[model samples]
Target chain A: MSGGTTTRVDARGGSLFAGSASVRALVYVALAALLFGFGAIAPTHLASEFVLRIGAGGLLLGMLALSVAFLMSQAGLVVLGAASVYGGVGYLFAIAMSKWDLSPTAALLFAFCTVIAYAAVLGALIVRTNPLAFMMLTLAAGEMISHSVMLEGLRDYTSGADGLVVTFKGAVFGMTAADFANATQFWPIAWSAAWILGFAAFAVRRSRFGAILRAIQENEERMRFSGFGTYLPRLAAFVFVNAIADVCGLLHVLNSGFVSPESLGLSVSTNALVAALVGGVANSTGPIAGGVLFAFAQDQFGAHGFTQLLTGLAVVVFIVLLPRGVIGGLIEGARRRSVLSSKRRRTA
Target chain B: MRAHGVIALLIANSLALASLLIMLSSGLALIYGLRDVINFGHGALYMLGAYLGYSIALIGGFWTALVVSPLLLALLGIAFEYLVLRPLRGRSHIEVALVTLGLGIILGQALIFVYGGEARGVDAPPALAGSVRMFGLSYPLYRIFLIAMGLGSCTALALWLRFSTSGLYVRAVSQDPSVARMMGVNADRLSLLVTSLSAAFAGVAGVLAGPYLSVDPGMDVTMIVNCLIIVVIGGTGSIAGAIIAALLFGFVQVAGSVFLPDLAALAPYVLLFVVLLIAPRGIGRGRAPA
Candidate 1:
């Protein structure tokens, strides 16, 4: 905030409004083409089904991390129970289809609306607290959902610890269960979902509401003194992030054909958090990349049965040693170079 | 008067649970009061204490384990203050808390590695093993011991906070750190003391939990969650409020388990949300963050 004008301008942003716009646009188009080509071709190039499966899973996780990062950066509130929405949407989807006997598309819409309502109600109750209390409440709420799933009374609905197998025949978003479950077929779906969610988060972060949210986060008292409501914007932000997680969770259920208590557990939420930290909470891409990075790391670490240990270590190391995150750090370094080069050009 | 006996049993059960919770939550509340950072590794410290107690009890007796565990934990507490807390003093409270959460996960996983995934049980020393007739009802003697310890610690904590110079300093700092520091209070020195003391209490609670709750890999998460709920409900940094919240949480939990077994696990969470709704800042006189 105290930085000089040039320093404060965010050189790395190099937004579309800047000079040499056509060149940047060409670069972006080329990048998009490259990404689209990768999404189409990577499944075939990767020989092993295991790698493709993990890759798809990584995209889903990255989307979840994007939501987590969005909340953390914009609202200055860390949600420790993102899995509730992520897994809750899946559970609601399964329950809606199996119990209500709704059609696949109806169930998908029903599940999405129901979970958003849940997020609204939950967010309304929680978004008024200090950040620390807010974080703890989210954790408690996540555990509550996980525990609720295991209750004998809810067993018939949730399938207790065994979880529910959700297999839908008709396409909700034009992809059947079989299509989603197949590794190669699922890759593009996951990739597209990641891109959409990432873009949505980025757009929201750049919105006027995003400015208000950041301002409230910076100083709630001052915002209040300035006659801002302070509560509704935060509540909206909470529901927004949860909506992102809801979409990610739906995709996960579609891909896996399974919704279990474990998915709603604290571990999954922390995993998303760890992914966000590793990728950097500053931007949308960092979290998605982080999700993929952590997923692959977990895959390796799982072989040694040190996944949990590594998760703990990663949280500490990322926050302490690399607070900007791997991607955030890279962006910072790039921005610094650009600024320095611009300084030299001006002098010359 | 069987109904009376049943009520007595329920209260006793809740008190036993609250006893351990009081020890754990107070430690958490104390640290939050002084440093303004919740020790997310607190549950891990308790778990470490329990695991260490399990081994020590095997070598000596439960008595020896109780004496030695807190002493060992005090050293770890000192190390934590010097090694982790002091170094990260400049970071945001949330960041520090996240670091502790990470440290906790590492510690918990390491313990799991050493002990494997299985739960370990420790005998309650022959003296407190059997049930005793209390108020015409047969009650487990170990529970009575636990309740006694809970009351003992509460009194000790109250007296210390009320009478001692350090206690006065702790209260002043907790109420307003900036003002306390301006008055020339050595906050770092005080933080070291409080951190170690909190760790020692957590150790003591862990050692006691072995015979009561059974030492398991999952216990740390459960206890930590419970402590977090209590601290939040009590109003984040208020020690007085935390004690009351622990008691309330324990009663709700115990009663739920007895009457609503199906939803017993979620009772505390229900209590938490309800409290949060009614008093978002919590039931205590916790100062808002500046």
Candidate 2:
């Protein structure tokens, strides 16, 4: 009788995530390749440097959103503090280079690993809670990181909100700091990173581990009863998404050659979330597209000094009207049209 | 100053901060209990109240602002219930929360546009502005009034929840919505009441915060994050737990500022993590997780 009741409860437990991620992996790869190709070549062809720079920023934001969307889709958890890992990685890199006099390459490696560890430690604690609590904790944790960076004690190291300008002492991944900072040069790099991160997210979503994650998210108790360790999968997913955010953050700092408290602010994380919402959370391309779209919208609104106002409006509109996000909505529309045409042909 | 004097001041300060926090977090907890939705815009509402209070106080006095802000917010609370909350009732809680967050951003931006991002100061009425001596230590009277208001509200909240039919319904819905619905409890009506009451409390907290914390565009975000941390630490829907957590948060924040000075801003977060480490489910006697 108890077993029967448990299964029944499990059936209705994941109503929030009943329909998602049905597309095959091959499709994801093909779409990613197409996007990467366009992103890589389009910047070179376009004459406007301003647009390319904005596009690069969008790709970076998209990369961050990809991480956010993955966790949201797979784990039924929203991360409100992704900016910490993203911005924190940059701060560590700059600090390592400046304070410890480490080579840029070494600092890059050190910062990446450290942020991964930070994510692991943070994820271990936060993933134990329910989804809402998880969301709340992420936001708090993000704020904690932001505050620490501005600590008066760390003023010499972090510069106390004046921000740290990082000049690479040695070649990082065989590219000079100047190369990374150039708008035209940075565009392809950001585009490539977005594709790599997008594929990483896709691979995780397709793997057997991904299946377990979805199962756990859908009905954690059922998965646990069936002998799966639900905790580790979630913790792993948390780290995995944050690692994606970390990579984006590193790339962001690399391109900008600067890191500030603003990078780690709640607004940064919210922007990524808004991008995820605008683009759709189910697949990689959606978030990337959403990021690009948000970047452009921000640029437009920035002119009017209404960036945040539009951002807030966008969040409401997208969540209410475009629940699946722009890419998701567009895909759905195309699929519906195809189905309608097929039906007409069949009737004829 | 003597060690005892320092201790006394610490306690007084914590009580003042905790009073404001309790006023904010309790409203957040109550609404969460009733609706299973965290109003991410609670901070923006608080900001709105502070701004409104500033304007109203300029025309009348601090007393008038305190009284009028909550009444106006109660009306907005009703509108929020019928409009935002009701329309989004069928949506997922996360989605609804996101919408509230978005609305919060919009509202915050609107206030910033009007107020132009400068911090606004509201003077305490002449009666509460002066310091009073107690036990050989002088303390600000406004904070004393704040503590009194805090204690008064707590007593009122407790009494209402203990004796009233609506309050009981709220507790019932919060603890077990399905069971309460099966019993034919009108959750919608209860939610409406909770929403308005919570908004009113946020208004009160905002007005109180003006003389204490200063009114600014950024206050909404900071207060919301603090309240969110408190709510999470207290266990999402646990009202009693929220109050206790607010007290703890208040003490930690105050003590950190007084003692550490440098790492003061991060004190509440440290307190939060320690509590979460010890009790993953939170420091609350609330319902089991879904």
Candidate 3:
């Protein structure tokens, strides 16, 4: 009797995903190529140095948003504490470079290792909860990071609210700190990171682990009965996403050459999550698209007045009118058109 | 300061904060019980109440602002329920939470735009402007009033929930909406009513807070986080639990600031982490069925 019930649930996609492998591979390659092409030509073709700089900045945020999209679409988790990982990594990078006078490459490597350890611990704490609890825990985690960064005793190292300024020593991939800071020089690096990360996201989505996660999302109980240990996959996904956020934070600090408590604040997390939602969290491309749009919007609207006001309204409008986000809406329209055409062909 | 006097002062301060938190979290619990919607915009409502009270106090008096601000917020709550929240019915809990999060952002920023970025404060009523003797030390009359009001409303709410007909209806809907619907109870209307009442409580908190705390754009986020911590610690949908959690947090915050000034902001978060670790469901006995 239990076996019958389990099979019925299994058919609902808990243990298997039915997407065509070849089609997914093609789409992933095309996405990587598009991002690579955009990065290579953006500096030369994009109007002014300002917009190119914004594009580079957008790519960093896009990475964070992509991580958001990854966790949401792959594992059915919405993380509100991504800023903790992002900002925490950035602070580590800054402290290593400025306080310890470490080389840029060494700092990046150290920060990456530390972040992996950090996320592993945090992931273990939060992976067992429901969505609501997960959200609050992540939020609490972000606040904890922010508060720790701003503590008075830590002022010597973190620089507290004044922010820590770093001058990178040695070269990053044969380029000086100044050269790397150049928008034209930085675009390729940022682009490469995005492309690689995007491909990684795609690969994970098509992996067996990804299939199990999707299954867990569909029905946790069914997966458990199937003898799949659910918590490990969920925790692994959380750690992986945090690792991605950490990379983004590392790049962000390198580009800006400073780190502050604001990097860990709720606004940073909110922007990334909003970008994921706006771009559509269902696929890899949505977050990248959303991040660029948000960066541009912030660039334009931030100057006038009440930037937050506009951004806030934008998020609400998106949620109410277009819950699936921009990419989701387009995909839906295409699907509907295809359905209608198929119906007409059948009728004929 | 003498150690005894300092302890007494901290107690009074924590008591004052406990009152504000009780009002905020109880309302949040009530709405969560009925609507299953965690109003992230609860903070925005509180901020709006403070701002409106400030304006009303300029023309009328502190008492008038206290009375009128929450009434005005109840109207906003109704419109919010009708427009923004109603569309989110039958969606996943995360989606509702996201929409409310968005709503909070909109409302908080809109206030910032309208009022500008400066912090505004309201004067205490003339009658209670001075300090009064309490314990071994003198305490602000306004602080004592806050403590009294906090205790008063908490008792009133507890009694009503236990005794009143509408409160019974609220309890019924909170326990199980589908069953309540089968029993001919109007879930939608009760949700709307509960949302408005929740908003009203936040407004009352805002107005009461205006005499001491500065009204600013940033206050919304701070208020939301505090109330969320209280609600989570108390367990969702449990009013009495909210009160206990509020007092616990109030003392932690004030006492933390005094003793471990650098880590004061982290005290509540640590508490939240420990509580969740101990009871994944929540700290309260009133556990909602997952």
Candidate 4:
């Protein structure tokens, strides 16, 4: 079974997007340009403060969605409770600045250390579980964190339900705290973060490690029989994706200038999952694109009080009717058309 | 007598929580048993039932709501099984799980749209409104009724599963659908029956829980997660296991609330983690034989 499984995965991989490296490069370059283009144009042409703010949120969500997409696509794990990691980092940042009175750089460093450590410990325990167990465990973990944040004992640190208004003492890489507060100023940083993380995921996807990860996803049992210690790669992917989500959490807190328990709620986690699925979890680009669209949709419907309706409909329709998500559906359609045209050429 | 009273009060509270947990988790366990579908939307169904109960109780009365809500929810459950769950017959468990998750969100949001965001509550029926003397202490009559109802329904369900023909079909389907079908059983019908029955169970629980707990849109997610935890700890697809774990956790939660208020919300989750560590297959595996 292991041998046959490995060959099947290899065959599928080569036949799909990997057949043409040049095409892949062109796709990567185009994605990078589009990401940068959005950041560049949003501050000037778009210019609406509300639009910029929503875009910033979308970009942050995009980062979170990319992390989710990475795990779902590469590891076959549907993490239902990512809010623990996301909100955990947000609280960490808020506490660092407000309670501990740490500078931005020191606080950023602290957040990094804590996030990696948290992911390492949680991922080590979680990566060993089956898919269902993984979902339940993550959900439990997220709930536990959310509960703890609201506890009276942690009120001084977490600010309870009122949330903590972060007072940035100094500049972070030439951008003042006020600059970070402004959505337009923060848009560039958010885009840069998404681009770097998105490309990193794309690069990893194209690398040999990506194939190995996919194989692990396809059949962990087979991969194990093949003498590959599958645990470390799985754990690595979990931690990496978690780290990306943690960054997203941090950016969200920094941009909003406040952090609250809502950041870690089940809704937040579910929203990220919906965004990733709709964006097409098959690739990094799809989730990022999906996050932007989702945020825009959220802003639009939220004002009119149809946010939940739209979100629910989007998730159900996308998964049931179009499982590939918007981008994935488009990609599949193009592939099918290409295949048909090639068949015609052969007949000619 | 005073110390005994405190203990009795705690026990009563625990029983109330346990009954609610049993009602919600059993449905989840049953659905998982029959189809291996996690039905993340179980919570939404529960919420919808509560809302329906509120409306019906207002228009017709508590007794009428109690009867009508489950029937209506069962119909809705059938529609759900046919419309959403039926199409993805041979898909991966995760895909089905995703669809349910989406459906749950849709249902929850639709509930909010219809019922509004404010928390709503139903009143205990006039006859059962006050306190009753139980175990040498005064306990809410409505709560005691809930406990009795939960225990009675659970017992009835257990017996039906063990002895009835339809129950046998459900058991056979869970054990192996193909084998069950080979034996001339209609697997599709059985699947629909189990799904609807499971959903009806959730609806019943929701109606019972409305007066005890808040009837609100946001309650769905939290309730679903709790039911998920209970199902996991008990081992999925095991009715007996869900019942036992629900009772155990109900006590654990009440005890935690009394002794460790700050950690009470986390007590169940922490217990789940420990159970996963010690017995990854879950404690009910051997006992339930699933």
Q: Would you estimate the TM-scores of all the predictions?
A: 0.96, 0.94, 0.92, 0.92
Tens digit per residue, CA lDDT, model 2, A269-296: 9999999999999998899999999999
User: Per-residue alpha-carbon lDDT of model 3 for B1-290, expressed as tens digits?
Assistant: 68889988998899999999999999988888877777777888999999999999999999999999999999998998898678778677677777788778888887877888898877899998999986668889999999999999999988888999888988888888778889998888988887888888888999999987778778888888888888888887777778999999999999999999988988998888788778766777544533
What is the lDDT, from 0 to 100, of the residue B280 in candidate 1? 89
Candidates sorted by DockQ, descending order?
A: 1, 2, 3, 4
Native-to-model Cα distance after best TM-score fit, residue B152 in candidate 2, in Å: 0.8
Question: For model 3, how does the per-residue alpha-carbon lDDT over A63-101 read when each residue is reduced to its tens digit?
Answer: 899998899888777888788888888788888877888
- Best candidate, DockQ-wise? 1
- Pitting candidate 1 against candidate 3, the one with the higher DockQ is 1
Off by over 4 Å in 2: A1-35
Clashing pairs in 2: none
DockQ of each: 0.85, 0.69, 0.53, 0.49
Candidate 4 or 3, higher lDDT: 3
Record all residue pairs in model 3 with backbone atoms less than 3 Å apart, i.e. clashing.
none
Instruction: Compute the TM-score of each model's chain A versus the native chain A and list the values.
Output: 0.92, 0.90, 0.88, 0.89
| Count of backbone collisions in candidate 2 | 0
Model 1 lDDT, residue A59, Cα: 86
Span of ten consecutive residues with least summed lDDT in model 4 chain A: A3-12
| Candidate achieving higher TM-score, 1 or 4 | 1
